[model samples]
Target: QFDQTIDYWGGRPHDDAWRAAAEQRIAELRTAPLTIRVNGALGAPVPGATVRVEQVRHHFRFGTAAPAGRFVGTDADSERFRAEVARLYNTVTFENDLKWHDVNPAEQQRIDAAIDWLDEHEITLRGHVLVWNFEVMPPRVRDLDAEAMRAAVHQRVTDQVGLYRDRLYLWDVVNEAVTNTEIWDRIGWDQFPEVFRLARAAGPNIGLAYNEYNMLNDREGHWRRSLENARRLIDAGAPITTFGEQAHQGVPLVPLPRVLELLDEAAKLGLRIEITEFDLGGVDDEEVHAQYVADFMTACFSHPSVDAFILWGFWEGSHWRAGENAAMFRRDWSKKPAQDAWEDLVLNQWWTRAAGETDGAGEFTQPVFYGRHRVTVEHDGQTVQAIVERTPDSPDWVMVSLP
Candidate 1:
């Protein structure tokens, strides 16, 4: 098994330094001060008004890789999957439906339905991969000559990216290029950046990301390769906007400190880093899995350059490593310790809710987690509510006028 091959922290003394640093950074970077102002309909300040601020969503993207089969099907499992997704995540990436091999005419219908559901929920969708230089190519692609393969790839990128550009927040323009070099060898390394150009032209407004695996552990020098490839692509005029690290870990988990170090190094590229595919597949103990999950999430969340933390899968039945039980929930949808840990952090520990009476200036000010908040004020037997987004770029104060 893969677990036996790597070094682990098994039964070793756990250090609290990394956790402390993460907590400090989370407080410093994830919060902002906001002032809520209340006024009467005629523009008089309503002093001592009761004010409440409740966060409705997170600005940071907490996401999962969703299987379209479950999202679009009518089965009980599908219902459960969709419910959990809507409850737990604000962003999603289709597991296999958006990949090169699966984007056929028949699968497009299912993809459309899934996109519709995501739109209705207001969840952000990321296109999994526009190009993966792996063996999962269609039969026609396997035997094509160099020129024909280039043409095929160009057409595929144009068609798929143009089709869903409006709905997607980003696209993995090229995936795992560090290790999977079939396309690189077939089309020449010089043309790799052109693929990103194709995606940029097709999806003018969406972000383009280059995704790779094994950067967290770095047993294979994949992190260095990713950095080198990123520089090459950028130097050659690829408008790469994000760096995607598929943080798939097994039994001997990479230490939290090392993970943070790698993140810092990746952030040096001046691109937003995403923990694109995170899952604990190799650990046997549930408690260990949960702790690692919390630590990994904290490390990622603490980093200012990190934009999103996405789970590879959430349920074991639909998980890629289903045999190893790498998900937070079982096939029956029962919660695991990892799930509890995730919820506690995402919903309770990191969540923001505040209530207070406005001052003589009719202003209530507090530091809050950055996100959309419903601000409610009550005065003179009248209640007024307004939704405001508390981003770094938002104005200093929000105004809610009472009737």
Candidate 2:
């Protein structure tokens, strides 16, 4: 069994049994082979992304051919993009802001293009947002009467959510809605509720998220108001499955205590929570940036309610705040120190992996004892390790193991 230590940080030392199981799991992991699986149901794979399995390297290539466009003009060949995406990201989120613009220059075509590209690459698509108060107002709606404006908003929500319901798994039902408290108060809280209702009506099984920013400031009133809004929504019967706190402000300003408080409060609502838009910034010290990310992720995953974390944009070049250098990867696609920290703490250190002798059918089955383990494999004098984590609720890691 692994030795256990009880520290003030809420982690207990591993007991003997736990240690023994971990050692056995580690040994098994050291001998396992590797395989990568792509699931079209999960959405599009981001191109030019790199994934590491301990010391082994895997590159994700998107299969979609490059279109004759400004953006695609400089991109890699279609087949190469496909292979690279397949090797890198397990999932991809469709860039949909342009589709929400009032006079979207390429509206239908752009949406179709993204969908087609993802389909060809067998990538899953996530409809970024349904209602972003600052971004979606058409000139006509802006000039319309209050009632008409509300109707327009409702229609927009219904149309977008309904149209993509079958293809997208999740939607930022209302992005940054709470930030404009005055607008919501004046328009009636029902305006937001209606958006949620319309989205659910359009797509029953689709996951809905309420995404926002500055949630980790540690300001008492801010935290209280955020939680109160969530409670109010749940009380009003909105089909809100997730609460997304946008961590865009970057490290130094985001108080750890406040993040924990937000998680704890949100968990009470019985909804899954996500740090949907995370970007670490400002601090040039990579180590500090990484530690902050590690600590933040540890707190987030440690919470029972958080299901997953989606970085706003993984690379600096594509980040909304690209000029500020707020992403895990630099513009050149080289990972920053924060990236390593995240990989180590969240992906490797917190995950568990194991390998076992294959049966006559070249299949191996082993029960991964609870908690995180690193599985390794030694082939032809070289060793590789894969990280896996055990959650308190599920025992199934088979699907995760293949990737």
Best by lDDT: 1
| lDDT agreement with native, every candidate | 0.87, 0.56
Once model 2 is optimally superposed onto the true structure by TM-score, how far is the C-alpha of residue 89 displaced, in angstroms? 3.6
Query: lDDT tens digits, residues 1-403, model 2?
Result: 1112312223422122323443443334322334322112243322222223232211111111122131222365334434434443334555544335563556556656656666665555556677776335665655666676677778888888887788776788877665665435545678877788999998999999887776665556766677777777888888888887766655234445556666777688788777766666666656666766666666565555666555666556556766655677677667888778766744455443443443333234454324434454332344445555443443443322222
Q: Give candidate 2's error at residue 116 in angstroms.
A: 3.5
Which tens-of-lDDT digit does each residue in 165-242 have in candidate 1? 899999999999887998889888987899889999998999999998988974657789889999898888798999
**Error of model 2, residue 188, in angstroms:** 3.1
Give the number of the best model, judged by TM-score.
Answer: 1
